[model samples]
Target: MESGKYIIVTGGAGFIGSHTVVSLLESGYSPIIIDDFRNSKKFILDRLEEITGKSIVSFDFDCSNQEKLREVFSTYEVHGIIHFAADKAVGESVLKPLKYYENNLQSLVSMLKISEEFSVTKFVFSSSCTVYGEPDQVPVDENAPIKYTASPYGYTKQVCERICADTAYASDHLRITLLRYFNPIGAHPSGLIGELPLGVPNNLVPFVTQTAIGIRQELTVFGDDYPTTDGTCIRDYIHVCDLADAHVRALESNSDEEVSIYNVGTGVGSTVLEVVNTFEEVNGVKVKHKIGPRREGDAAQVYADNKKITEALHWKAKYTLSDALKHAWNWQKNLDESR
Candidate 1:
């Protein structure tokens, strides 16, 4: 990646995309965002500019539109493309598999076609730990077998990974980096921008925040009968800022390899109950929660063995769960203030 080159960030107005845009701008790379606003807001662009002290060029377009994507590439000389646009709700994907496939799979194909046409080789994919399904071990590594997908959304990611690998292998110029991210929580330190989940949040942090703010009556502990320390499901919750930083590193480490996949996580696991306890302790408020049956497509335990990313890109997670919770609280407060 060029030092001051422009990077195209699809879905840059979304949760992980916005935070990654901040990291890219701070690291001296200009980011041009593209989104359909189906799951994001326009105010996020303003917040990004306020944080970076630079104007951001954003396009309100869907990544699945091949013609529009080609028009974008013709208009801008982007050196790299970070594809983060996708429908990522596991439960909803089970309900709407066609929507997930149409958006996730087609958007990736459109982006790859544009990348090939524009000669932009560097591609960073926003993958998830869901690709691993129910891992056989505690801390899963990059080589962990991608078992059968639990939901259609998870299957889309697995398919996209195959698409990236095949595309890279077919061409000598394409360089791809698949950053399989774990749970990304927290907001920017400024708290000006963070995740904005539509309807009820599927993730833990947002649900906890909503309950704290009285949007929801109580949090539902998905399961407590699993075979684990606390019986609740365990996950490696990494800060969004740390996850975003890894994207910048992956973009910079462009090479002619077929495909390079890295697990972006904290190499730590926390139980669902532990997260609720932490939230209550950090926010000085009680989160009304009750243990419920395991949600379908839910994994028992999933974390990351982030040794590959640390050794390859010299990147590691810096913030802890408490720090992430604090930032998330700040972001919640900011959301309240904005409303």
Candidate 2:
């Protein structure tokens, strides 16, 4: 660990970023949160303090802004960086490819340039499994081919991974770990902070929670026509807490490789129907859902192999899918209570 031992969590007030902040603080690291509050809210920082019992160091700014990025670097002796500040909606990316490409790529490029310039040795990029682009095989391994992405959001991850690799290949001091995470669901167990999407949710768990809470009319199970166990899409839903801890593990793991890419997931595939049923079964909340047509660019089934990350970082997911749903439901309830 560097002297200051401060980690810069870009997009730190958002879903995964907020949970990661909790893990970072618990694991003996100071986190400096930088977010533009476009997809997140300022109240989340307060909730983070409630969860961790520590004042969060945050800056309200976009990571792509070179001046604000410099201010963060200069203000804090940043030893490490976890880049999670990117536009991440698949459907939105499909409709607005330019916006996805611009924000995702530019923010990452700025982070890399700053890391290289300031000699920030440890960097973790929040990549996604969408880079797989519906792999022909099940349980995608780290060596899985980087197929053409289905959306501009995914394409951004693929390109960012390459950018990190290329930058690491050229720099002797920089070490990059690209964590290709699967579907990350759930919130912090405290109910103080969790996945709170602005407006409608694009992911499954939040939508399910909202519907279960009567915030939304019903949950739409997109594309149940896929050739899966239930004719619905299959994904490995890892708890956001586990995924957050993996960031700390990645930062602390010892690796000589300049750039290491690992698939972070639960190594288990659960269909959309399975997730919905499990959520209802565990939480006793009936989610009125409908099986709709297959979404475009929707994969038949995609989960992680996860052997590489376990062996490399000595990390494995500990929470079950039901645990994620329970936490998600609790978080929704807390949000209602807070309101």
Clashes of each: 0, 1
For candidate 2, lDDT tens digit of each residue in 217-301? 9887888667888888899999999999999999997798999988989999999999999999999879999877777778889
- Per-residue lDDT for 1-339 in model 1, tens only? 223588999999999999999999989898999999999999999999999899998999998888888777777778899999999988899899999999999999999988888887799988888889888886999988999877999999999999998998887688999999999999999999999999999999999998998889999998899988989999999999999999999988845576999999999999999999998898798889999989877788898999999999989999999999999989998898889
How close to the true structure is residue 32 of candidate 2, measured as C-alpha lDDT?
92
Give the clashing pairs for model 2: 223-294
Worst 10 residues of 2 by lDDT: 1-10
Stretches of candidate 2 off by over 4 Å are 1-3
- Candidates in order have lDDT scores of 0.91, 0.90
- Candidate 1 local lDDT, residue 291: 92
